[model samples]
Target: MSHVTDVPAASPEIARDHFLRRLSVETDCSDVAASLRGGEPDFVLLHVVGSPQAYERRHVPGARHLPHRDISAERMGEWPAGTLFVVYCAGPHCNGADRAAFKLAGLGLPVKIMIGGITGWQDEDLPFASGKEPGVLRP
Candidate 1:
């Protein structure tokens, strides 16, 4: 076996730990869909942007809108303590979800990023809602 000095491979246990930790901070489209179906109260889903146009076009059903630039610890403090927030944005190419997650986490709120985002949801053929109506999406 040849080993590269610049890129050392992680041991199996280390890799598993890293992946598990990542899973704790990230969720996928299917999981989010299931949560919506079950109406889980442990977490709240949010779309981290203020663009009414984008929102009006399409977004996850039941996701609340919160622009990342406008997020604040004081504002977040109004939420019930220990409430986990699952945030997403346009898609994998967008860093909005990561940015929002970092901001919320810094504010001491539990946060998870919905991997793949709205684009991923659509790609998976998941239902999406448009307009200002929450939880009502066009199939």
Candidate 2:
């Protein structure tokens, strides 16, 4: 049999559960772009890696710079506990997004990873923002 069929696929119910669970914690570049382009995004988008200058040079428009190393409960308290955070990093090669998500979750905050990160954003030709602020997109 072809490698594709080497292992049977999960049943539809099982597949739905698996995807639903994944969707709960992850988002894609396209979805994020659409949300940003549409207007005010409901979730906060954060860049979880790089220096301030690097972020200013180029980053998903409206994304706030917040390295994974800097995430802390006290630092995150500026927003209400329920504020959902969507984090991204340099690309699939980077784990900074994962680290940030862990910290945010540890603080009992809602969080999700913007899958594909900057690389994905670039792939989709989405606009980026700069400067320091609410980790949100500029109008």
> Runs in model 1 with CA error above 4 Å?
1-9, 136-139
**C-alpha RMSD (angstroms) for model 2:** 1.9
Model 1 root mean square deviation, Cα atoms: 2.9
TM per prediction: 0.86, 0.92
Residue 75 alpha-carbon offset, candidate 1, angstroms: 2.1
| Clash tally, candidates in order | 1, 5
Best candidate, TM-score:
2
Model 1: what TM-score?
0.86
Query: Candidate 2: where are CA atoms >4 Å away?
Result: 131-139
| Candidate 2 lDDT, 18-100, residue by residue in tens | 99999999999998888987798888888889998898888888788889999988889888769999999999999999999
